[model samples]
Target: MRSKQEYMEKAEELIYKTYNRFPVVFDHGDGVFLYDTDGKEYLDFAAGIAVMGLGYHDKEFDDALKSQVEKLLHTSNLFYNVPAVEAGELILKASDMDKVFFTNSGTEAIEGALKIARRYAYNKDKSHDHEIIAMNHSFHGRSLGALSVTGNDHYQEPFKPLIPGIRFAEYNDLDSVKALMNDRTCAVIMETIQGEGGIYPATEEFLKGVRKLCDEHDALLILDEIQCGMGRTGTMFAWQKYGVKPDVMTAAKALGNGVPIGAFLAHGKAATAMSPGDHGTTYGGNPFVTAAAAKVLELFEKRKIVDHVKEVGDYLWEQTEALSQKYKIITAHRGLGLIQGLELSVPAAPLVKDALLNERLVIISAGANVIRFVPPLIISREHVDAMLIKLETVLKKHS
Candidate 1:
């Protein structure tokens, strides 16, 4: 096989230069570890940006995918497939949502949810309620419709004249959301736990208040759980911890255990507005991807993954909290489950680079100054201890 440097050089030549990726080439992985082409090993704490729920090359997930490939891969929405139905059934049963619309990615799910929110309002009264209120520092997606609702000015600045009628509010601040809600507001979208803006979770009281405000105003409450859902934070959905249910919910990331799949769910009344021909996707719920998703759900039951996440997440938080006191450069540690973040006094890019090159630990950043830890749900206590030791040594050296 070619060396890592050889492949990386070719990638820089051929691939789009949009992303400033780390200087490493992952060849294959298992559980919470990855190996580069140079035979170097690294503890994979990023989990492919929170997508690899069961970790790399999970046996059950792989077996399901192999079986699905041997059978029918896809026949489109023109006909029904068993894998798609099974996945949808599990999602609905778990979430108590009335219906589901599958898509290929998180951004597409966001778009579909936004469309449902607006279409539901339009059906009631056209041209009246069209505004979508989102939160500041929140991330929905990169597509035009999803991007319009994202509240970051930097991301939206280049793409001027985006889809209008989208307003911004402060996350976890009930008054900011209430002030933006009016007759024109069709829906309010937000991440239950703000993932990209930093791993800042919404206060329980704040979420309850928002639910009441949306109910009182007759506006749809949309929760974007793309990152924090799917057993990442000890629950199937983060909103479950808050005790508030949204009219519309979008999820992806870990839905397929690594396969590209996203779904937007709607409750009884909100789902009714979508008709047969209103929306569709070419490869949204293909049998191959949905089969992987079904297997992931099955593994969840067999493994009791949620309970594992709760235990491991608490252990990680405690270890990280201790590291915060030992290292002055570390500011704070915040999160629930495996989805945690550490805030640093300075930019964390260099520390991350050092972890990869010097310590052989693979972690990603949430923002400029925060390092996000979202390892595979199958990761054990021993894996956590190993990572913590390497990470702590790197932080001390940098400090």
Candidate 2:
């Protein structure tokens, strides 16, 4: 009963088979490392799918949560709570957006953003036939609403008859977007940096062009930053790098630094479109989660996390580039700041397995061949160096 295998077997019997999860049964985490039930330490590069930006067991973050738990937890959105208001204010300030709606998860945030676009159009034109243009090879979320706009055929095929008006366009290709977009297009949704589709970053020119197109068509530009936001891209949000502001931006993952919070921030027409009946959430802006989010945001500012990302991200990119040079199996390295990926000539799954079981290093795979590196933002140069050595051992075996 104490063994990892026993726990995993029990989980397999009880849990749904939706995920092909790894065999590692993690019991706890501290700083940038996770310890399995067997107490095998792993240098964490995945960071709980980019959720643990500040790393595990951060004293300040944990203490804030502890305090909030004692003071208040759920007052619900039925009435006002201090943390919700404070978190909303901080999110709006960070994003420079006029309004925000909190959600329980990133999927909900995407759902909210899509509704904002649709409702905004409806308010102006009284039209139900509005189309949403999303990028090809992009990942949004698993909800029906989020899935409707997710542009991958594999993920969308089983769930057909999705929201009727979502169109797919090529990422970083303005012409492809131009070809699909028209007057009825109410929103152009995209990941600020495509994560699961092999870690591609949007080129400055393409993002700027999309902004122009949205402006011309009077369509809201919804940037899904669930994976790329929260200082992963050397800015509070990835679009800030190019000075292109989205009408509506969806955020999650690192937003609460592991406390499960998501938000959609909007400005101008999109902000005004949502009335009380248009959207609502019972547990979305509860005192507990919003307190975690507010504290996370406050810590981000105090720690100068954005500036730290810039410095370390440069170092990470350099080290990855060096590894690419050394290992001919690597075809390309793509991404910005901390969210880097290495596309290998061979399948990445085996190497990832080897990294975990043999090297005791945690990394993730994306789009079949890309090895994703989204370590905790709190990781130092020494942590990256450690990850490199362990990863190199696996790479050497695989290559």
If scored against the real structure, what TM-score would every candidate get?
Answer: 0.98, 0.99
- Top candidate, metric TM-score: 2
Q: Give one clash count per candidate, in the order shown.
A: 0, 0
Native-structure RMSD, model 2: 0.8
Q: After superposition, how far is residue 316 of candidate 2 from its true place, in Å?
A: 0.5
Poorest stretch of ten by lDDT in candidate 2: 1-10
Tens digit per residue, CA lDDT, model 1, 148-182: 98888889899888998999999988888888889
Where does model 2 exceed 4 Å of error? Answer: none
Query: Model 1: residues >4 Å from true position, as ranges?
Result: none
Question: TM-score of the candidate numbered 1?
Answer: 0.98
Q: Best candidate, lDDT-wise? A: 2
